[model samples]
Structure formats: C-alpha cells, structure tokens
Target: MSFTDSSKKSDPANPKDGSSSESEKPSNEKQPTKTRGQNKKLDRSSKPKTPLPQKMDEEDLGICIQITEKLSNSVYAFGFRSPPDPTDEDGQSYLSATESPMDFQTLLNKLNTEGYRTVNEWKNDMNLIFDNAFNYFAPKTMRYDSAIKLKDKFTDLCQMFTKSEEERWMIKIEKLCNKYISADNEQ
Candidate 1:
C-alpha cells in the first residue's frame, strides 16, 4: 500500500491551525522578561589612534638595494667626470673636450675588430659599451659623454635620425641612469 503524504496537513496544536495546547504556547508570552546587566555603553571616541608602518617585502627590498648601488655608482662617475664646473650665462660649461691631435683611427680599428662596424653603431649600443668598460679603469662619465656627443654628431650627419631618435636613445639612457639613482635613494 502507498503511504499518503502528510506534508500538506497542519497540526491541530500549531498557531496556523487556530488551535492550541498548553505545551504549544509561545515562550515570549509566558516567560518573564530579563533585565540587561550593567548597561555600559562603549566610549568609541576615547580609543587610542596609531599609524601603521609601511610594509615592504624581502624581494622588493633586495631590488631596491641593487638599484641604489647602480645609481650610486652612476652618480659617483658623473661627479668624477664633470665635477661641478662653472657654467656660463647660457648654461653651457667651460669643461668641454676640444679636438685632440692624436689619431683615434687605431682605436676605431680596434673597436671594429670587436664587431662595431661604425662609431655611431658602437655609441648606439649601451650593452657594447658596458661590455668594453666593465673591466677598464677609464672614467664612466667620459665614456657616457663621448657616447652622447657621438650620437649628436651622428644625428647631424644622417639628417635621417631626428630629434625624436636622439630623445628615444640618448636622452632615455641618461634618464634611466637618473631614475636608477633616484630609486636607489628611496630604498
């Protein structure tokens, strides 16, 4: 035999059925109310305020240290090279390098043997300069200046390499050095 479902039928003692038993009385109506203890309100205004310290992780700290070191070296090199020479009213320094009588052809030939096809190409590649100067006792500032001057002359010669090209390459390199130093100081 199939059992009839009783889910739809309401109990006689339930309030919804409009009938009640003593056991089915509402506890809120029958029970006495309890008084709240102490009634103490919190003084939120009296709480102490403190600032949180900024958090930097180990990896970030390491990166910051490395960047700082690179920048410090760059700054030291710049100082060594151009040591705060007096500037004219036009803002140009008197410390400019004049043309030397020495033959730079031997040096250019040496550079060519090391895979630099042109002086302009050599100046364009920072990685090449870095590789060449990595173990040299030569001043970095001088090397950087030569690279910049070469680029300037190259632009004038080609007429194809615009101001934007100089901006994209030479100016960007200088800015990167400055940024690296700045980031290093922040750490």
Candidate 2:
C-alpha cells in the first residue's frame, strides 16, 4: 500500500470535519522558520555528545586498521589471486619459465604482455598505490583481519618506496604502476 503523510489527514478528535487541528496544520501552511538555536523541542546542543571520529586526524593510526577491514571485502569483490611469497625469489618464475633465458626482467615484462592489465592505464593511480601494494604482498590464503595487517605493512613499504625517490629505482615502479591499467587498450 502507498504511504500517506499523517499531517495531511484531519484530526481524529473531530472525524466529520476534514480540517487538521491548530497543532497539526497541513504542511503547506507557513510556520515560522526556527533559527539555529531557537527550537526548544530538539535541543541539539543539549543532546548526549559522542566523540567524533572526524576529530581524530591522519595521526590516528587506529583508524587505518579499521578501514583495512572494509578494504579487504572491496579487494575481494574485484576478484584477486594472491602473489607468490616475496621471500620466494623464484616463486613467480613460472610466468617467465617458458622462455629459454628466464630472468627477473622477464617476469616484470610479463605485466606488459597481452592479457595482462594494471589497475589503471591512462594515468598513475596514486590513490590506490597502497591497495595494490597490499594486495601484492598479502598471502593467498588469508582472511580479512590477517589481510588487513599485511595491507598495513605493504602501505608502509609503499611510503618508503615513495620517500626513497631515486630515479634509477623508480623506473620499475613506474612500469608496474602504469602496466595492466585498462584491458580495452592493451598497452
């Protein structure tokens, strides 16, 4: 059934007459607009106050942990397969194993190969740098909370990567960030 506004209906005290009482006038009638502090019914100032999270600035790291839980579900929503362990230097060798002269560069080059796609192609996704780094390092078989911890670690690593801005080391960073951006324009 469709809903009707209670104010539009006549007062129950006098059923026959369709007129609303003085207290319940039709909304179309003009009522004096209450200024910020004039209304006594809803004394927003006197209401029980809760500590606002917004007051907690970027310095609040606990907020980071809270957000990572949400990011875990989001990353999974897009569908992800965890990368090989960082310690296993030879873990992702299979991507380049088919070639006769398999090496680290070949593995990095795989990102540019056909069917490979990065998060964004046309531009650098500075915003999602943390997300991508986190996904890259997180274990394949981890749950939400564990994944969050891993994400935080990766985030710190990304920060260091940015801070250590040596051009020689940045070339690979640029390549990985730019590669696999858009599937439509496979570049």
Candidate 3:
C-alpha cells in the first residue's frame, strides 16, 4: 500500500479518527515562524534616536571655576599657604612678568637648584615634599583662608577672563606654589 494510505488506516482499539498519526496532516495547517531579525526591525521602527546635547560657553566657565576650587582646596588640605593678596605692586609685577608666577619655570628652577637631573625625579617625590612643607609652614587657619581665597579668585577670573587663559594661569600657579612651599619645608 502507499505511505499515505497506510497512515490513513485506524487501529481497532482507538478509532476516534481515521488517521493513525496527527503529524501526517499537511504543514500548511501550522502557523508561520518568527525570526530574531524580524523582531529587531519592528523594535527599531517603533523608537527613534535621542538627540545629542548642545554645548554652551557658560558651561566651560563653570568647569574652569570648579577646577580652580578643587586645586585650591587640595593645596590648603596639604598645608600650603593660600595665594598672597595682590597689592597694586603685586598686580603690576604679575602683569609685567613674561609668565605667570605660578608657572613651571619656578619648578624647573627649584629642581635645578636642588641638583635634580630630570623632571621625573622631582615629580616622584612631589607629594612627600608637599606634605612636609604643609606641616612646617601652613597653620590650620592659613589653610582655611587660602581655600576661601582660591575659590574667590577662581570665580573672579572666570567672570573677568577667558576660560582657557585663566586655566593656564591657575595651573602654573598651583604647581609652582606647591613646589615652593614644599621646598621651603624641606629646608
């Protein structure tokens, strides 16, 4: 007999249907399969991409102030004097100087004077030097005052000058001042 005819035959004990097996029915009777690609396409079309945020000049200024404040706080916490109050003479000197007093030039000078051959050598012991200086010269009250002054100067600079220019000055000042204080303490 043909395979189809054999499958159509029913057993005497179970005669609910003429077919012996349910799987022998046509595949067209079953539902279609869903794929991962199809599901992803549907998900993509359902939602849109979020737009990028806009940049602002004011945000840059705010960031500059934040950086300055942090540097100031760190210097004070490490027991260094806050920046000196600028008198008219100090202001004039600062303006006339080719570079900011806080610049790395001072650091280079200190390293040379101390007989260090490389910048890396100075950088390695920088923290210890800073701590020793802080312990020697900076009273608790001075640290508090310096932190406050540093915050104020940062705000004033942000309002009065360009962010990038102010940042250069602030960085130079921070490094030089820290180095000087530390060196003095070492003595």
Candidate 4:
C-alpha cells in the first residue's frame, strides 16, 4: 500500500485475466472543482454597505460633551472615569470579558475633537463603558452594581436630553407660526 512501491495492482473489475467490465469504467462527465475564498468573495459583495459617518454639528457636539460630563461626574462613574489599565491585577479579566472597552475620558476626548459624528454614536460609546464594567465584574460585586447604576443614570439623562431638544424645536416652530399669523392679520 506504500505510494513509492510503484507496483501496479490488478484492477477489481479488470483482473489479471484481462477481462473488463463496462459498469466499472470511468465516466466522461467532469465533476465540478471548488476554489478557495470563492464563497467568501460572494458573501462580502452581497453584504450591505454601511454609510459613512456624518460630521457632528455644533448642537450635537454640545449634547455629546454635556452627556459625557454628566456621566463622568456621577458617583457611580468613579471606576470608569478613565481607561482600564491592562497591566494592573484585574487587567486580564477586563480584557477577556469586554469585547470593546470605553471610558469617560476617551468619550470626552472624542466629543471635544468631534470624533463621533452623531449623538447616537457618542451614546453607544458611553453605554459601552458601563457594559464593559458590567461584563468584567461579577454580578454581586460593587463594580458591577456601580455599572448598573451608571447605566440607569445614562438612560435617564439621554431621555431628558432628547425631550428637551424636542421641546425646544416645538417652541421655535410655534413662535414661527404665531409670527406668520400676526403678519397675515396686519395685512
């Protein structure tokens, strides 16, 4: 059975007697061959493209800064105020559990430099900070509890921020409508 033997064995259907059977002959039809990365190319091409990030406007940038400031100032945010130190004792655990890490300082830096294009993008990073903390710390641990509190605070802050923005827009619209009506009345 060694490949290097170079000795030819008699075929099962066509034995040493030189008799051949028609059913055992090779077929003329060629079997299809598969190439590497063929399916990967199709998958990548078929995937939907994500739109590029838009630049953050003044108002959006202000909101981003304000949210980050508020979150950073919270008592529950003490642990997540800065980036995690991977060289520290708990570093390996943090690195292992959190897929993407975030911190208040990093968020603030991004906001100041207009790193995020939308409020939602900034919000996602903020959420990631708490999520990372939660993932790294055990359920009953103080750090985990802190993360829960911070997450709740962030949620409340965002809801209030959105409502205030909507209210401001509505007030502006109402004033514009009033001015239009007053101008029509004067005519």
- Predicted model with the maximum lDDT: 4
Every candidate's lDDT: 0.41, 0.39, 0.45, 0.77
Pairs in steric clash, model 1: 68-184
Considering TM-score, which of the candidate structures 2 and 3 is the better prediction for this target? 2
Quickly count the clashes in candidate 4.
0
Alpha-carbon shift of residue 124 in model 2 (angstroms):
8.4
Look at candidate 4 and give me any clashing residue pairs.
none
Which portions of model 2 miss their true places by more than 4 Å? Answer: 1-142, 164-187
Q: Provide the lowest-lDDT 10-residue window in model 2.
A: 114-123
> Can you give the TM-score per candidate against the true fold?
0.16, 0.19, 0.19, 0.59
- Best candidate per TM-score, number? 4
Give me the displacement of residue 186 in model 2, in angstroms. Answer: 43
lDDT, candidate 4, at 163? 62
Error in Å for residue 105 of model 4: 0.6
Q: Candidate 2's residue-wise lDDT over 1-187, tens digit each?
A: 1122356655667746676557654567688899987876765988788743422222223333333334434544222233334366554442233212222222223332421232222012222333443434445544334445544654553442243336635765676666756553784
* Candidate 3, 63-168: lDDT as tens digits: 4334434543555444332322357674444334312223223333443354344323433333333333333333556644654554455445545344476785
Could you tell me which 10 consecutive residues in candidate 1 have the lowest summed lDDT?
Answer: 94-103
lDDT of 3 at 143: 47
lDDT of 4 by residue, 21-89 (tens): 767687899977768865554457678898656777675687678877987998888888987788886
Model 3 spans with C-alpha error above 4 angstroms: 1-140, 160-187
The whole-model C-alpha lDDT of candidate 1 against the native structure comes to: 0.41
